[model samples]
Target: MKFKAQLHNNTVLYRIAQSLAKLGKTAVVQLSQEFIKFIYLGESEASFQLFAPIYMKNIFVDYNIQSAHDNTIYMEFQVDNLIKVLKSAQGNETIAVRLLRKQKKPYLTFKISGYSRSGRTVLIVQDIPVRVLTPVQMSHIREPVVPQAQVNILLPPINNLRSVAERIKSVGQCITISASNTGKIKFHVASEIVDIEVFYRDLINPILPNTKEFESDQIYQNHLERYFSCTISTKNFVKFLYAHYIVPASISCVLIENHAIIFTVYVTTTAIGAHFEDQGNACGALTYYIPAFAL
Candidate 1:
């Protein structure tokens, strides 16, 4: 087995690791000729899941992966350490990630190269130990599936939403998120003595393409005025906000009404434009599935 890839976008690589570090210390990585996946396969006791796959064509100028095991390699490594090393990378540096065997142990190494202030070339190598996962170990892991979203709306800047959500977290245990196909969304919190709500109007309510799985009444096209609301743990919701550090070009939410909220955080720039429905998913997206809080 052999794997070595050069990542030109250091910022994206750093952001991906930072977000995963929020939930746990380690994460699973899958590498193939097509794309490299950075996954956070939520804990058994929790329902949060993250799937971040970056195609080599988009982010890597140099890509190589050769494995007798179906041309793919799966490994798990410490995300906390990965983020700490990535933090040292500067804007001008290129990170070459590779899988290495040292002293009979597996390791994921990041060799960063760039020029220093004195015009001399600088090299920094960060070796992160990893455990190569076998086929059986990763067999059952998969992305979550839910019913077609009832309302799909583009979110405001995550920094703004995160700030508000963090404050609300101090006074509430759960937050009720309500949305409609009419370009409106509301975040409401209530207690025995307080009821507070933050509302946004005239937001972009993207027209979701008709899917065969969507029922006649559940489709947003026909129910523009209907609202779908779900209450989710305030803590978990705030944790999801940390992804804003990646500086997403845009963030969109698919509300399944009382079921789950799937956020599509676009890592690529200009994800959705004039032809939003056509171009919204043209590039890779970081998929986050946060289950609704059960009463």
Candidate 2:
């Protein structure tokens, strides 16, 4: 079995590793002919699973995969170790990865080459013991329903969000995100000593699939105009906010009352606009889900 590939964008590859490392110490990487997937599950039940998929043709300049026994290859490694090697790569460097078996053990060799110098690092494959909750089981476990109140809002600049979140996170255990169809959103944190609310107005509210249905119903229409609030762990939400630096494209937030809020960062190698439906080929995405809490 032999697998080798070369990626053109070292920054994007490093960002992918950084996103996975934010969730857990280890990451499960599954490579196929079409795409590469990185999966990471947090240590806590309330923590969300980080799923990043990068299309082969979109990210890689040269690729080859040949398995003697299987069509797909799966391996696990320390995210920090992989990240350490990836950090050594300069912005202009090309990343080369090779998977080979030695003495019945699998190993991954990573090489970073630039115009002047190059470095190589080899890591032994390790097994990830963590088991992530599947989407089916997650729905069952959470008993999530179609949110009575939902908001699809365009996110503000990542640096602004990160700065506010960092300040507010120190004051509260959780942050409350409130949104309305009036194009207003608020991030609030309240504790025994201080209460702070950061407001952003005139934001675009993207039309969701059920927007028409909600518009026709008087009850849903009324609910849409009213502020819908969801609380999530401040620490976890801050981690999600930090991923903005890794994603060069636009980011969007979808909030579902008493259910889950998802932060999706559009990733693509092409110049095409960001669309939620785009997947694989020239486009891929990374999504971070934060479960809502009722207090």
Best by lDDT: 1
Candidate 2: worst 10 consecutive residues by lDDT?
Answer: 124-133
The segments of candidate 2 whose C-alpha lies over 4 angstroms from its true place after superposition are 44-46, 66-70, 91-95, 112-149, 208-221, 247-249, 270-282
Highest TM-score, which number? 1
Model 1 lDDT at residue 171: 79
TM-score of each: 0.87, 0.78
Q: What TM-score does model 1 achieve against the real structure?
A: 0.87
lDDT of 1: 0.79
In model 1, the runs with Cα more than 4 Å from the true position are: 91-94, 208-222, 269-283
Clash pairs (backbone) in predicted model 1: none
In the range 44-138, model 2's lDDT, one tens digit per residue, is 55567666777777767678876643456666678787777766655634567777555566667666555543455332222212232233443
